[model samples]
Target: MRTIAALELADCRRIAAAAEAMAAQHQASVSLAICDGGGHPLLVVRLDGASPSSTAVAMAKARMAALNGKPTADQEAAINGPRPALLQLAGVFKEGAVAMGGGLPLLHSDTCIGGVGISGMTPELDGAIAAAAAAALQGQPG
Candidate 1:
C-alpha cells in the first residue's frame, strides 16, 4: 500500500484562520469551509454580516473541490464555455459541485488532501479568501 499525508485538526484551524484573515483584509464578510480528502467537513466559519445562505453554499463548494481535486472555478468555466450540458449533472454527484469561483483544492505532494471554499462576498473576494486558505495548507511544514 502507498502512503500519503492528510490534514490534521491543526491544519484545519490554520486554514480557517488564513481564510478569515484574508476576508478581513478586504473588509469582506463571508462563509469559509474546509473539508477532508473524502469531502467530509473539517471547519466552517460564517463571518459577521454574511448572508445566511452562504453556509450551505460554502460547504457544497468545499465538498465539490475536495471530491474533484481541483478548483471549482474550472468547472464553472467549462460549463459557461462549451459544456452547458454539465449543469444537468450537478445533482447526480454526492457533493453538489457548484460552478463558482471560490473553491480551491488542497494538494500535498501532488496528492489531494482536501479543499477550501469561501462565499457571501463577491466572487473575487471569495476566491481570494479560498486561495489564501489553500496557501496556508501549502505553508505547513512537512
Candidate 2:
C-alpha cells in the first residue's frame, strides 16, 4: 500500500490558530474546519458569535477541498459551469461536499495532504482565511 501523508495535531493547531488570527484581524466571527486528505475531519473551531450553520458548512467545504484537491470555489465554478448536473449529483456522490468558496487543500511536497475551510464571513474573506491556514503548512513535513 502506498503511504499517504497526514496532518499532525500540532499542524492542526497551527492551522486553526492562523485562521483564528485572520478572523480576528478582520473582526469577524467564523468557523473553521480541517480535514485529512481522506476527507476525515481533524479539527473544527466555531468562534464566538459565529452562526450555527457555519460549522456544518465549514466541514463540508473542507471535505470538498480535501477530496477534490482544489479550492471549493473552483469546484463550485466547475460544477455550475460545464457540469451543472454535477451539482445535483454532489448530494448523492459526495456527502457534505459543498461547492462554495473558503476551502483550501493543504500541500506537502506538492501533494495534497489535507484541507482547511472557513465560514461565517463573505466567501472571499472565508477563502482568504482558509488560504492563510493552508499557507501555514507550507514547507512543513507531513
Candidate 3:
C-alpha cells in the first residue's frame, strides 16, 4: 500500500499561534497562512488592522514556498526586471504567487513538509516575522 501525509490540524494551529505571537511581538499586524506540501492553503489568519488584500498575498507566498521548497528570498533575485522568467515557472506567478520575502518553508526532520506566509507590513518586516516563526519550529518534536 502507498502512503501519503498531510498537514495535521494541530500543526496548522501551532503555526498560527507561533506566527501571531511573533508578529505581535514585533508590533506588526500580519496576515498569516499555512499550506500543505501541495501548496494548498490549510489555514489563514489576518490580525486586526491587517489589510484585507494581505490575506491573498499571504496565501500566494505560502504556495510559492510549498511548491519550491525554498525560501522566497531565493526567488527574489530571479523575479526582478523585464527579462524575468519567474512568471513562466509552473504557471504559478499568474495566480499571484509572490516569490519575495515574507514566505518560508516549514520542515520536519529535514523534510520540507509545508510552508508559511506572512504579510501586512513592509516586506522586510513580513519576512522577519515569518522567519521568526519558522525558526521557532526548528528542533521541535513531532
Candidate 4:
C-alpha cells in the first residue's frame, strides 16, 4: 500500500523562509524544494530572479537523496558502478547530483525523513542554503 507523508504547510513555509534569508545574504536568487520521506514533493519555491531550470533541478536532486536516505553528495560520488542504470534512470547527472555540493538529506533521528534542495547559485552555496533551511525546521513541530 502507498503511504503519504507530505510536509505540512507551516514547515514548508519555515524551510522557504530560511532559504530566502540565506539567498538574500548571498545576493542570489534560488529555487528551493522540500520532499517527504518518500521523495515526493511537499513544497517548492522559486525566487523571482531564480533560474527556471533550477526548480526542476532542485526537486530532482532532493528526491534522489531523500529516496536513498543519504546525502546527495554520497550518492553522486557512487554514481558510477557496475549498474549504470541507477544513475542513468535517475537522470542524476542532469540534476547536478554529482557536483561537489548542492543537495543534502533531511533527517529526523537516524532516519532520513526528507530532503531540502536549493539551486541557482554556486554548488557550495546551494548546499549551504539547503542545509540552513533544514536546520531551521529542526526542532519545530510539523
- The digit string of per-residue lDDT tens for model 1 on 1-142 reads 9998889999999899888888888999899989888888889889999998998889888888888787888878988999887676457675655868899899999999898889898877788889888988889422
Better of 1 and 2 by lDDT: 2
lDDT for model 4, on a 0 to 1 scale? 0.75
Residue 60's lDDT within candidate 3 is 89
lDDT of each: 0.85, 0.87, 0.81, 0.75
Error of 4 at 62 (Å): 1.2
A best-first ranking of the candidates according to their lDDT comes to 2, 1, 3, 4
Cand. 3 Cα-lDDT? 0.81
lDDT of 2 by residue, 83-136 (tens): 777576357635787889999988887789988989999999998899888878
Candidate 3 lDDT by residue in tens digits, 14-91: 778778877878889889999988788899999999999999999988888888888886777667765378756548
Worst ten in a row by lDDT for model 1: 88-97
TM-score of each: 0.92, 0.90, 0.85, 0.79
* Best prediction by lDDT: 2
Global fold similarity of model 4 (TM-score): 0.79
Q: What is the lDDT of residue 96 in candidate 4?
A: 36
CA deviation > 4 Å runs, candidate 4: 1-6, 80-100, 140-142
**Clash counts for all predictions:** 0, 0, 0, 0
